[model samples]
Target: MSSLDKRGLKERLTAGENVLVAEGYLFEFERRGYLKAGAFVPEVVLKHPDLVRSLHEEFVHAGSDVVLAFTYYGHREKMRLIGKEDLLEPLNVGALRIAREVADKTGTLMAGNICNTTIFQRGDKEAVAKTRAMFKEQIEWAVQEGADFIVAETFSELGEAKVALEAIKEYGKGLPAVVTLAPQATDKTYDGVPMGEACRQLEEGGADVVGLNCHRGPKTILPLMTEVRRACKGPIACLPVPYRTFEECATMQSLKDPITGRREFPVDLPAHLCSRTEIGEFARACRAMGVQYAGLCCGNSSHFMRVLAEGYGRSPPSSKYSPDMSQHYVFGSDPSFKKYYQEGLIETVSLNNKV
Candidate 1:
């Protein structure tokens, strides 16, 4: 195995280097038919270990600097929701081990994952305690498996975000904590805390990196993230869903079908995915704004990741196969190409030319 972490994630970020993290395991695995969409628990880590490892490899090849564990929704509450509370410990351990193996082999940072419990309600001390316990076990397993950092992501409630940060500080064994929140359609956390103030609080609470992830797409999230960048004194992480969220529908959940006017989220959002070029543009924008850490959240794929890498001025392993339209048979301008082929290509391929 290759040596891991020549320079740690925090070290690189502190040195002004951008670290690309590939998340979106919940949606990616569901699309692959291994994970259930509604529940979204990462049983694939235990049931389909090879697939999980393969995805980690794909992200690494596509230029991801961090191999985030596929434990996004593998918390105690989520597992218990699906009546597999028995699988909680095994699932978390299995996911961490898979991520560690890949990170070690490829010399990338391995990040343990935790997300919102969905059970935490503000001012409810009982719910807060339950949330803490859930985070404690996951952090314990992550630290035990040698994770380089802990990524607490997709929490829409700022209250819960602090709890996750607190848990990380207590149980993370001094590893870096990357806490990213998911603001709702209002452009604020579910608890009504503005995005900037929320991120500011996280940084003040000792988070290594603070920003937003999930829910909103690139266009919608960037404006709020700008506020975070200005508010926080530390590195900021921005990983938006690869979708084209607009003014009317500022988040994937708020997206509506053009014809049917029905909701198209979770399972029916393929038509709304952002093109590779769009992702590249988003990456370039982030870099220009001095954002230190970047990546895509849900709806992320390897090709999309390659675009992000290239946008950030990186050429990952997959870049070797990036598009070379100049070499296309129908559009080639190379000297060796037949002039007749290029001249008639539009006429030959155009549907409008058909009799």
Candidate 2:
């Protein structure tokens, strides 16, 4: 399929099509040497370019329609911690180079991605200005490198998302922008803003697509997307964390005790990771609700992207999967009826003959 431009992308989503974007760079970032979120910015871009390229290739092969550059933490604050503060431009450029190469090779859209730097406070003029400057710098590099869109994601506050979108408009040079928050099942950002209000504010702030990503599974976030759809008029996207037991933990970030606030890590989180069937099923649900962008956030592997694409890309009335028939076949269609009816007849005849 041909890649869509900004208007084309929005149009396709309006038509109930899934714009599958690969958003879980943290998974591969850990697989390399960067064990934590803070260490990934410099290491992945400067020390290990090969791993980034390989991951991008894997994402494209796994059916990602859009490949976001590994700019998730490419800001100066994150880099200054490692004394690679001067390498800010290099890191952002290097990461985008790898993503651009793979995207160009595979014919996928390349998105410039940035996330929140700190907890957002609305009245903090200095902090907001600084954050916007950081975003502007990143957006400049992304635009210079020929990115198709800019995604300001994983914000805990609505104000940060609004700042990112404004920065995109200032430096993105007319590229489409996507702003996604990290919301909980309570329909609120970790910073205490309502999710619907978040989407509405971003839509008013000039975001082309407004939605949420990470911190929970599709099962938990599906209902929340309804509120997002109501607030966001253009296009809505949801990329839940690839976790399973949403009942136990509504979001990966809140893996702490509710009362004690004790956190757990390296503590058998696989139980929270969704199976391939679960991810695909989530994608199917997104399509039904008119969600144009179906993506993943944390714990996302290539297999997860593949499954999501397969499920969301299926034609209407045939999106469900069944072991007895091809996934492309519609449920309860003539072919399915014949297959089951013939099997039933054969079983009845065999039983009667044996008796």
Off by over 4 Å in 1: 1-5, 335-338, 348-355
lDDT by residue (tens digit), candidate 2, 1-355: 4533434455666675668888778665774446465355545677778888888888777777787899887788787877778899988999888889978777778888889876356788988888888898999999899888888998878778888898898889998898898876467875687898889888888888989887777778887889988877778889988876366667665565446667543243454577888888888888888888878887788778878877876331112322344433433445756677677778988999999
RMSD of 1: 1.8
Give the Cα-based TM-score of candidate 1 against the true structure: 0.96
What's the lDDT of the predicted structure labeled candidate 2? 0.77
- What's the C-alpha lDDT at position 180 in model 2? 92
- Residue pairs in steric clash, candidate 1? none
Expressed as tens digits, the lDDT of each residue in 158-216 for candidate 1 is: 99999999999999999999999997889788888899999999999999999999988
